[model samples]
Target: MNGKQKQSYKYDKHKQRLFIIPARITSNVNNDILVIDRIYDDDDGRVVVLDREGQVKWTYQGNPQVNSGDKLFNPTDIVITSVGHVIVSDVNNHALHVLSGEGDVLTCKVMEDQGIIFPMSLDIDTKGQLWVGCHSGDDQRKDAKLHVIKMSF
Candidate 1:
């Protein structure tokens, strides 16, 4: 093999052959693997956190408190904050989800009023600022803009 041979393994502890579509991935300061499970079926999108040993630590489907009327349709990207919180860009929901290190839903906000068309990606800088890139919801693609928000933690 040109690259290092990588072994394949399943994440689901119950189902031996359950398939997982990992769209985006990142590692926390603790070396935990955070993955965005993008299954295109009856099931909604979810975020799976795994330990260094490939063991499933916790899974976050969506934040009910923020998404009271909808499910986590499509999570495009994820970034772990300095405090170990996982921030996800909920594309279809038009929202940003903040999850605690242990997979608890800390907060969720739909930023439609803030001119967020379709947030597709995000990252945190050394100064603790969040930069969000969005796809234009308008047909002409003229509404696309980058959003910068100062993050405390």
Candidate 2:
């Protein structure tokens, strides 16, 4: 078998829209594909989850209670934990959003309170610690930080 497009999902929950811009995608153990769709130039976006059949399972448009105004959901990267939970990087909001495998918004972990900002990338360690690769938002300083956080939920 050569290179061939299996299925293209432009819009979630059906129709083709191509609304996803610069998408970051990953698959969980359940064969569900998680995509981080950066929609706007301002880094505003949402996470779209689809099944193996290329059908939209559910869409999480950010938790309204936690995200609004300047602090909207701007997901840049995504990863599925060992337990099948989804962790999304909200760089602009300096936070990480944890979603259930079914696309339910579980918790919003605000990293700013713990002195972490611009959480760009994520990975889970062998010991189950979430490693966050971050970059300083300051234009003048091109610095980076790595944080390991152990979470339970």
Candidate 3:
């Protein structure tokens, strides 16, 4: 197949809900488009989910309780589970956000205490194990690590 651009979407940043610095874009098993939008250079990010028709389904802007004080959402990667649930990595906060297919906040798993300093990317293997790519403290580039966890829906 020839590599060619098939479709594109554009939105005015000031007029509508626009995509600001989209880091990663993917689709779920149900064909729902998921995007990690970085509002700033590396902070204040959100997850924008869209339907196959390019219609805005829902958006997640980080849980308020988790980003209250000095912490920012800082989403870096996104993945959808086999059951269509969404998983997002919050590098700034060192946590993985699990959400329902309809965009409800199911739970937040903080892995900082477990030595996962900066969770950057996520994926679910065929066996349904959750794979997390993360970075350690000061020397993130040199000390990056990948962890696999057995997760059940």
The TM-score values for the models, in the order shown, are: 0.85, 0.89, 0.89
Please give, for residues 76-136, the per-residue lDDT of candidate 1 as tens digits. 8999998899999987678898888998877888988888858889999988899999988
Cα-based lDDT for every prediction: 0.80, 0.83, 0.83
Q: Give the lDDT of residue 144 in candidate 1.
A: 77
lDDT of 2 by residue, 36-76 (tens): 77776666898877788777788887877668877778887
Which regions in candidate 1 have their CA more than 4 angstroms from the true location? Answer: 17-19, 41-43, 68-71, 138-140
The segments of candidate 2 whose C-alpha lies over 4 angstroms from its true place after superposition are: 11-14
Instruction: Report the number of backbone clashes for model 2.
Output: 0
Colliding residue pairs in candidate 2 = none
* Residue-level error in angstroms, candidate 3, position 109: 1.6
List candidate 3 stretches off by more than 4 Å.
Answer: 12-17
Per candidate, the number of residue pairs that clash is 0, 0, 0
1-153, model 3: which lDDT tens digit per residue? 688977666553334755878889999877878888888657788898877666778899888878767788889888888788889999988888999999999998888887877888788888999999987656635888999989876
Error of 1 at 127 (Å): 1.2
